[model samples]
Target: MDRSQVEIEEQGLGANPYGLLLKALTLIPSWHYFLAFLILSLVFLYNFLEFHFLQDLFSGFRGHPVCFTYNPCSVIYDAVVSKCRVLRGRYCATPWLSSPHLQTVFLNFNGRPPVFSYRRQLFYTSDGGTIALDWLMKCDVSGGALHMNSSISRNETTPIMVVVPGLTSDSSSAYLKHLAFNTAKHGWNVVISNHRGLGGVSITSDCFYNAGWTEDVRVVINHLHKEYPKAPLFAVGTSIGANILVKYLGEDGENVPIAGAVAICSPWDLL
Candidate 1:
């Protein structure tokens, strides 16, 4: 451990340059290595969860709605969905508003719907309540020129479609307006059946419409049928309206005057 030994070590260090680096690493505390390992483990876990769980859940949550029927092999189902080119197209959501909740909020609060004109008709319910029916008799016409056949909207035999909006919604709702406008454009007479005390109409009767309310709809259908006996009558309902329509149809069965009906977003068993 004297001058001779020190000289020997210095000569060995000079020969191998890695000796200094190895000596410095040995002086570091063990805690530093442990902290580095912990950070690496956390990073790996996050990536694993993101790839295996989060991605699939988000993607599936935003998937397009499925078209289904009780009898999948029914000829009517195939003709309605498969043969219809417009309905066959898949829905592609906006990239930024892909989430269902974001899409709903944006559509309700921020979305812009096309404006159209309609003639409002108020019906007095038997129970002293009021119902509003907004009619789009001639929507495809612009500049006094008919885009579709004039007979489609003007003729007594033209088909008529009745629209029933969802709970807390009215004829002026964006979705109802869009549906009415589209149906009218396709040469069918469209009418929106706003619930009692809805569509800006005040509640005159103490009775209120609920999910199972079918009396108002029955009255409307009977009146429409009597008014236009030649026109084929059809109905489209959404949400609670859909539930009401289904119940009405079930109750009336063959007695219902509707030629056909469509129910969208019906909540059959939800509390």
Candidate 2:
């Protein structure tokens, strides 16, 4: 072949696009590939150990909570046992979050909570401490006017649920936000009773909330009852807040202002 033909044939053979990639790959050490594979395997194994798919698949459905009251023939048992869907229905947990520990961890780490815009009311306590009450009123209530003096005409009698959050939790907590949003959606007015020194309000006095402190809860309920005298008032307390609420009910006895109360995950005893 002539010089031109030889040059053209050589260039064609040498111009292969994959040749550069093959050369670069050849430079990588063999142990690097093994290390990469080992890291990937470790990650996969850790994730597999963290979430148990087999156990969740079989034990996702749980029984309902037991009903307790003064009498079996009382209206509470009749309504709760027969009509209340939450009491009568099966407690089916999400299969992915079957374990209680796993559920708590997942909720803390990556919970997807509903969005809310609350009308904040800062209440000063007798000891000069501050409590933030985040109210999620009805849809018709104007956003700009949430004060006691505002024109709340027909909705004055609407039921109100005062939610007291767990220790170190506030209205911004995922669980409390979900509870408030869901309760408000059902035509009831919901308010998150942020603990003293919590919910972005600074502590003004020496008074601080502990696990068994019930004075804060008592004052909040009484204030809400006084402000909306016609409105039926209810309270829901979770975790440390539950302890406070139960103690308040016991302390106040029949004089408690709330029409009903619910305490979730209350501790058995406090020292």
Candidate 3:
């Protein structure tokens, strides 16, 4: 009654470790599984609502009545609040215009001499990477011989316009050619800023250019500024190149050194 009863009580079937583990496993479905399901459901619902609201906002901007139908009270409140902020005094309605159109023409004569001698130059990055740049300059005249025509001079007062091409574009690009020709006719020196990999030269580093990476532009601008301190410098960029230019301008703000800049068809928001 003493030893056997004590052994039986110590090794009882009701005190099985495996049974306790099984009971705990069954309780997991009741609480833990429910909590996991609740969390996932909340995440999905939040994402869905966010997407729906954004879609409605975009639809409203597109003149669709979806936002008004879905959230009429909020839309009405916003409209009323915006209306109350209006000023009573006269405000100029006309948008600001920058430059005037000028009659421009490319040289049509085939017999005339070439204006500039084109040369390719290489620039090194801070990390010892190199990028090839093509530069065009008016030819130097010599005694008793006709050199390249001086269509534009790089005097102290002369204006230099640096043309940056879009993705995979270079100095030989049709747009760049047209721009160089036009600006040359107006007695402006032009240089074409080509990207690292796309301009027929192998990129030294693995780092390729993106939309807002204006380091190359900054380098070129610094070089030009050093070369022609008194000359006015301008830049024109197209497409992705335009994005780089705009980013540079915005980053530089009022401290930009260029005399002027022109960016066309630039995508301001990359994200």
Candidate 4:
């Protein structure tokens, strides 16, 4: 074989440069090579231990393996999420919770900021008052205008999830936008219900939304439902807005328009 062909054959058989290293190590003492291998093994073991140790140290202990108290129910995976609640809230969490260890850790303690790139749609709270929503549409028409003027058919039964953030936050808040992004990715219609005068929307009313005030929220949910009757409506609220949502649910009771609701970290009894 030619010199080039022979060199190519050697490289093909030892892609990891084993031939060069074997020759180089031959010139060195056998004890030195053994010491080098020992060092590498310790490094690998130390790295492995450090990764798991640090993760456990930072993440804190997980929720009890047995779901809730007073019931001998052992292990979390067996318990249905909807079985127990703090104060008998309106919403029911899904049962059968299972996730990878690394995933659960990140999800529980994912402090990273959220990134949002939503197309907004404006809605009028009252005749003169208006609010802007970060719209996440999944219409059949790709890149078509889904602005306030664009007409999406009521026949489309998109699963809609409306998000309301904390008192100080808006559609762009890390928590709210993260949820909207994930839900939209799963083919659900997600929208952020920005409080009046917030989220870069122009303020037209003298009144700003508060923890107890569900008027604007009511209006937004009703308007969206009316516009898209075929689609199912679900609302999720955070912080003060969560209190408002619960109040709305309590007031409306069985007559509430939406299919289901969720409230998180609500200040129910703010004395």
What is the TM-score of each predicted model, taking all chains together?
Answer: 0.68, 0.69, 0.52, 0.58
Query: Model 1, residue 150: what's the lDDT?
Result: 36
The lDDT leader among the candidates is: 2
Task: In angstroms, give how far residue 68 of model 1 lies from its true place.
Answer: 2.4
Model 2 lDDT at residue 20: 65
- Against the true structure, whose TM-score is highest? 2
Could you give me the TM-score of model 3 versus the true structure?
A: 0.52
In order, candidate lDDTs are: 0.79, 0.81, 0.67, 0.72
Tell me which of candidates 2 and 4 scores higher on lDDT: 2
Off by over 4 Å in 4: 1-116, 139-151
Each prediction's RMSD over C-alphas, in Å, is 11.2, 12.9, 16.8, 17.3
Better of 3 and 4 by lDDT: 4
Each model's total of backbone clashes: 0, 0, 0, 0
lDDT (Cα, 0-100) at 74 in candidate 3: 75
Superposed by TM-score, candidate 4 places the C-alpha of residue 18 at a distance from the truth, in angstroms, of 82
TM-score, candidate 4, is: 0.58
Count clashing pairs, candidate 4. Answer: 0
N/CA/C clash count, model 3:
0
Residue 268 Cα positional deviation in candidate 3, in Å, after optimal superposition: 4.5
Q: Candidate 2 versus the native: TM-score?
A: 0.69
